[model samples]
Target: MRFTLSALALILTVAASSMTAGQSTSGQPPVTFTKDVAPIFQNNCQVCHRPGSIAPMSLLTYEDARPWARSIKQKVLAREMPPWFIDKNVGVQHFANDRSLGDRDVQTISAWVDAGAPEGNPADMPPPRQFPAAEVWQIGQPDVVVSLPKDYIVPAKAPDRWPDILVDPHLTEDRYIKAVQIIPTKGFTVIHHIRTSIVEPTDATLGSGKLDDADVPLEVGEQGVFLNEYAIGKQGDVFPDGSGRMIKAGTKINFQMHLHATGKEDTPTNVMLGLKFYPKGYTPNHAINSTTVSAREVDIRPHTDNVRSDGYLTLKKAARLLSFQPHMHNRGKAECLEAIYPSGKVETLSCASFRFNWHLNYVYADDVAPLLPAGTVLHSIMWHNNSASNPFNPDPDAQITYGQRTIDEMASAWISWYFMSDQDLKKEMDARHAAKTVPTSTR
Candidate 1:
């Protein structure tokens, strides 16, 4: 959570009020804007709900929120605001950036709406929050900013397009990158998502680093190292100190964009990516590895609900896991990550209530990172709902298969982790070589 200490205190204050009709304890005042609602909005909703943000309306102050009081109550009653869909009962509840409203907070909003959404006193409002300007980078400025070689035009009325363009940064030597941000010059409505990675031009024939229409076929079971991803509500992340990903010199950066055409006229868009590197000559104590656990041969039968697909990753060495991003297209229902230790102990890392529209990367809070020794197996299971009840279902009767289009389905989770030491890295490399000779099942 990006909430300040003072904002957290306000949350505690509202939570202290009884859930029963949002009433305060004896001798306390009723739930009011200054005392109750504004703080909750400030902490949870204001990130996207403020002016010039993605949300349709603003809820920053009493004047801004008063008109939408009843509407807010409706949305909260339906559990629609704040946009987090992770089931509280399933996953690790104490996430570092949890934006979900607590049950008591919901009840307080309900009670406030029931009580006419009163503005009890202007004096009780907390100090206004400070939001960064739109042009400013969320994690300060990046060391390098690379844009597309040329703008790509997206038709307004045609089907979606995945423009995979290759851009070369022309780095002379290796560098350790600490953070990255994906900035889309086009409006958000037309852009679905973007995935960026370093593509090694092993092919001597493919010489020029120019835009190519041919889709780069990713090898099966091949985990291409990714730099970053752009999705709704996603912000740039700074890796923990003494940790970063190593980027080699002369490597080509591939921009795999998933662009959706808004129902307007044709438009052109240019996207720029910003990269921040660690200090020159600085070596990271731990190197982060991003690998995808995928069940790409998905064949969801028509009208299937909760159809399960499984994938697994075996740790060849000791690793400290940082985050997991479960990804799927429409019809995706839920995703779970479990660790099967060498000693046979199974720990559930996360079992989130997944939504296709919200591609969330759940970063474990500090002191919560799980350490998996060699021979440990991590399992990924994703559930899909393709029945008529799924409003986002593109075709209820069509058998869904793995594809890049929005209509097609995908079942996968991106794993982010770091090897514990040099010995561990060597052990992992040896295990990978051994695995090449001995095939294993990932189910």
Candidate 2:
């Protein structure tokens, strides 16, 4: 019962140490949810980690995130969440739609987790981010919403389906579209990718194509001119001002879908296409030419790592690349886009780590978008990992070849660009060079 002064001090020191075990002792305040971490979640994780998203869990509130604090810390520290896989070490680093967290944001999350993931003052929490109401259309309200004629149902277990569903747009006059978004209304788990094309009235008959469960499409008729495509993580496409993709009057909208199957039975699911039109009577100066360079002879061996493939596309006319989106199935590891100029200079425009779940299109800033000469060649290099190390690989035992199914493998670079005259390209390049060379103080 006798307590010395030193004994009392020791007890108090132990209590203080217990209270601040994982917290900073250098006078810095402890990291808390409301004040520091919520803002970071709002800006980055909230987009896909919120409810109604493909993410398994939500991180919208303290209650929601506290349970997964350690997991969150692990993902952010590893640069796995937020689903941005752009390799920062090499190639072009700038992108208009970079969703990856900053170095400090990752640090903050790690610290918060270490500091017990405390929920500080509720008042310190930032305003909630607003999302779309009826649907999550990143392109906003569209001038027209096109739906598949009938909802397509995938069985509990089935091979990848590439059924072509045709629906007439019934447009009375030609319209230039600035944006396009295709969203799967249901069965997000089983949905693979949805590709759309416009079958102009000028073309021949819109043929029918059916992909049986065991069958792979060899030749399925005209795919039509591609309008746009949607994958699991694609936000949508938005063309620059004064440029767009045109939908001719009386055109049939072809929905070429790849719906794979999960173990459980999915509800009858359908896709919705949103098209935002340009202003009436406003003619676009340029037409967006969406193209791809595909390594058609894909041969991915089982238990292999770092499988390599290359594809090339030479510009027939001078063009400016607007976006770079790498396309692959489960085993895709990484891809790089390089510009092989006629002057013998090679430049890697971008190199992004591949995730089968997210086929994100990295758009370039308007000023820095690559403007290549007519003779410039675009080199697309892709890598595949088929070993046990690849987490997304469905089966590392099977050999994969180029096919339309989600199970099979392919190597492709999907890009959106617009062709321009030789003179126009030279003028644009000259303007760009002049801007960089101008003396800042002299101006």
lDDT value, residue 180 of candidate 2:
94
Model 1, 160: alpha-carbon shift in Å?
A: 8.1
Off by over 4 Å in 2: 1-23, 135-144, 153-166, 170-175, 183-195, 198-226, 229-236, 248-251, 256-266, 276-283, 434-443
Question: What does candidate 1 score in Cα RMSD to the true structure?
Answer: 8.8
Using TM-score as the measure, the top candidate is 2
| Candidate 1 lDDT trough over 10 residues, lowest sum | 207-216
Which stretch of 10 consecutive residues in model 2 shows the poorest summed lDDT? 208-217
Candidate 1 achieves a global lDDT of: 0.72
Writing each residue's lDDT as its tens digit, candidate 1 over 1-443 gives 32365457655654555344545554446789988888888888886777645566789988889999989998886666776666554435555566778887887888898777899889999998786543456766898888888888888787766777889988778788898888777655566678887765553223212213111223242224455777645667788899988776777788877777765678787777888999899999887766666674788999989999987777766777777788788899888888887788776777776776566677776445555666778888999999998877878999888876678877877777876864764555456456542111111
* Model 2, global lDDT: 0.75
Q: Which parts of model 1 have CA positions greater than 4 angstroms off? A: 1-19, 23-28, 61-71, 74-79, 122-128, 138-141, 151-166, 184-195, 203-224, 230-235, 255-269, 279-281, 421-443
